[model samples]
Target: MSHSSSDDEDTDISESEISEYEDKKYGELRNGVQNVKTSNENGTFICPYCPRKRKQDYLYKELLQHASGVGQSSSKKRKARDKANHLALVKYLEKDLMDVDVPAKDSKPTDESDPSVNSHEQFVWPWIGIVVNIPTRRTVDGRCFGESGSRLRDEYRSRGFNPVRVNGLWNHRGHSGTALVEFSKDWQGLQNALEFERAYELDHHGKKDWFANSEQKSGLYGWVARADDYKMNNIYGEHLQTMGDVQTISELIEEEARRQDKLVSNLTNIIEVKNQHLKEIEMRCHETTHKMDLVMMEKDKLVEAYNAATKKIQSTAMDMLKKISIDHEKLKLELESQKNELELRKIELENREAHNESERNRLEQEIRENAMKNTSLHMATLEHKKADENVMKLAEDQRRQKEQLHAKILHLQKQLDMKQELELEIQRLKGSLNVLKYMENDDDGADVLKKVDSLQKDLRDKEESLEDLGELNQTLITKERLSNDELQEARQALINGVKKLSSLGNIRLKRMGELDTRPFFEAIKKRHKQKEVEDRVLEMCSLWEEHLTNPDWHPFKVIMAEGKEKEIIDDDDEKLKKLKKEWGEGPYKAVVQALLEINEYNPSGRYVTTIVWNYKEGRRATLKEGVQLLLNQWKKMKKVSS
Candidate 1:
């Protein structure tokens, strides 16, 4: 239902009139609703007076329609519920009316009655009064109110409405507060107030101790109202006046002229002061410029002097560097020559050692062979002596046995001859007995038998004696052969002993003829001593090189402290002292001193290669070159000392 402009105006007037009439009629409704206990259920409409507890889940507009009997039955039961619901609705409406400050009913509706009045005049200035319930009771400073007002003002301003004024009031407890904000003439204040009220209700619902019971609200609550002259005066002070009280144009013009006269007079005075100040600044600037010119001239002179001094220093440094480089090269060459000689000496030593080792092995082999030959000779001599003793014993036994055999042979020969004669006599007696056999028979036969028996016995004795003689002869011959063999063995053993002795004598002669190595050993000892000296010299040269090349090397100065020289343990220190004494403290002395200091301070030489040479600055010598230079310096020192 869109209305024409006139109709809209009429409707607005009617709505305003009704609202005013209702506010006046139910001025005590807010108090009535304060005693009514409403349900806290959000978005739910219920009739407190109805016996049947019926709740309608509806929006506020729909709930209003339902309570007003729209689309509802007209039955007696329905009518009774409707009547009870209407009574509850009336209280809520009254509470809503009390939230806003409506115009009095007796006030004239000028814009609605007189159409000749401007439409803008019909619009109301939207003034909102908000109640912010603070959570604490602490003392509120003025800043708190100021911050709150500023926020509210900013909010209105952001919405394209210029807030005329924003004011705040704090309660004694500082636990609650109120803010009154007035915006430029518009009905938007009403909507803003309504939204604030809803937010306040939602934020504080079910929160304990948020409000003075549920009758009072918490958080932010706002209501719209017109700002009258008294309210405006209270908010903006007495400096603000209504449009009707504005001065006439003639009076305004006269006042503006007077203000302009004062402003022009003040501007003229400011101009005069500014001109005077400018003149003083100009004079100071002139003096500062003049001083700056003098300073520049002095700076030029100083720069020229500095450049000349730098050039002189650079030339001197270059010449010193060149001299050092030359010395370094010479030293390097000398060191190289010495190194080559040392290498040659080392090779010679190795060769001599090899020769000595071979000679020692040969001597040891000869000694071993001689010892073996001597051992064999000793064994042969023992064998020879044993053989000779055996031979002598055999000869003595042979002689004794020969004598015994001769005696036994003679005795046997005598017994054999006697037996032969007895046999002859028995034969003769047997012949006579045979002739007289007949005459003397028995006696004679017995005598003959006896004689024959004695002869047989004697023949057996002779045979036994002959057998003994033959056996003795065979034994004597065997003994003589054994003695002869033993004698030959002794002779052969003696011959072998003689040969061993001859060979041993030759070995001894050869040992005596071996070359003497005493002079070779002495030469080796001398070479070792020379090597030690070379090593020391090499070390000194290296130290001197480091001193020349390394910037971090700080030379030790031989200071006469307490009227005596400090004792240093460094070998370089001794060498440096000698050099300085001989040279009488020149560049050589400085170099020596630096070398000594480096050796004394950093024995490990860990920072030897850390120095970086800058080519742009000058021709800096390399480590090798510097080392050569140091060697030359050392050689000169040695020569001078010698």
Candidate 2:
């Protein structure tokens, strides 16, 4: 429930409660009490709430409101307002200067017309009236004026004149008063007063007559004049000049007054014009300052924008550089990969080139051998031809011999020529055989021997390679056993990991079985009833919770408060237990538990056992339906009782 505004009037209440209590405390005190105090005996002095001395703050506020009302006629009301302000200022200054004292000194000839002159021209306006509070009565020796007004009047009298009116201390009790005095008709009187008072001391009886003292104990104490121009009329025609020159003096005085009035008017106009110029200057200064501020703000914004753009550009450049670096790295890796591939290709090419070179060398040797064999065969053919030619020559020689035998007488002569031809033919056949032997030995035979030696070395190298392969196979067989053992251990570890996971799952299942219960759903049903179903569900839940938490309290007690035990017919204990068990194995056990905890219990009908026994065992037949049915009956009873 919210508090009323009246509460705020109680000062004991905090600020936050003020809003609630605003309306009740309209014009009342903070204590919620109305004021009954009346005004003063004189209506002009009436100050309500005066008995409460702590009303200074409120009084100031009321004074401000009063001043606002008198604004249009401010010149007329100004005197009253000034009185009030002066009274306040006097009181404040009195308090501030409680221990302070003014010392006395003689006056000095200091020009009051000079604005910047540091003479008696500067009086603390707020504290001026305090000097009037001084005690100066009982006609102190050598005094020409009475009490408080004496100090002011005598100072002016020294200047050969009197003030229109002056503030004074009338009695020894420091009572404030004012007095009017007349000045001489001649200007000399006024001039003398103006000059001499510039050097007169405050205390008429006891003091040096100079105004040059710096400390409070040795300084002139008279305040400067405060009378307005119109008041000066009161000081005329009473002293100094005679009645015979009155007319002429009046004329001259009038003319001089007119001239002073004209000068004042011109000064007023000039001041007005200057004031207007000052206002314009101030306005221009403000506008220039505002424009400069705007320009500076714009410059700052531009700088920020430039910085943001530069940052974005830098970020983009960094991103591009990153991309380029990645691409460069990728290209470098690809180049390295290609280079390695080329190197492998070159090695493969070199292997192929070496194989080709070996094949070419073998082919070249075969071609050389074939050439040598051909040369030998050609030489043999030449030798054979030579032998055939010899054989022919021999046959021819035989024929010649036979012919010679037939012509025995001619043979002796031809024998020498035949021998020479046969010898030439034999020499040619021998040369041919020697050339064939030289060709076989130098070409075919040497190449066959070199090839045989190379064949033998290659056969030895092949046998060594086969032996090395056999040892490598043995080493591979040993490594295979170690690898198989490692594989078997890894498989065993994987199986163990699987078993642990299965065990953890089984443990989790068992723990869930212990935690889940039936009360969970009752809470869920209660919330659903509040939101969308019916409020009866919540009522039922409340009743159920009472029965569940307080095992000793039964629903029958709440429903049958008149001790009507016979009306209690419902019981669902076994069903409740079955529901509880079902909740344990369900995946939503936490949610169900939360629900049941929220809505603990609600009775509906009779025990299932009672109904079954009545129907199956042929027992007494009176039985309620279930928890819900019992709830309906109890509700009906409640309505009837109501």
Most accurate candidate by lDDT: 1
* Candidate 1: segments with Cα more than 4 A from true spot: 1-251, 311-642
> Which 10 consecutive positions of candidate 2 have the poorest summed lDDT?
505-514
lDDT of each: 0.45, 0.40
Q: Give the alpha carbon lDDT tens digit for every residue of 1-642 in model 1.
A: 111123432222232254343333233334453222335556344433333445534445544455455213456444332343354355354234222233233432223233322323211223343334423343345323224667767876675545555655544333235555554222343345334444445565321334355565544544333224324533222212211122222343354468568878999998789667656655665665566567657756865786577568656755765675566557556655655655565455445533576886865665566556555555554564565456556645754665576456556645554444344434444433333333233457777566656655665665565565557567779999999788556544433333343222111111111122332333334546766755654554465555455555444455577999864434355655674554344525445444444454344552332221223343333434334444565687799999
The TM-score measured for candidate 2 stands at 0.19
TM-score of each: 0.15, 0.19
> Candidate 1: global Cα-lDDT?
0.45
Q: Considering every candidate listed, which one attains the maximal TM-score?
A: 2
lDDT (Cα, 0-100) at 12 in candidate 1 = 23
Residue-by-residue lDDT tens digits, candidate 2, 560-633: 55676343312344534453455333423333342333233122221111111133433322223222333555
Q: Give Cα distance to truth, residue 64, candidate 1, Å.
A: 40
Distance from true location, Cα of 545 in model 1, Å: 62
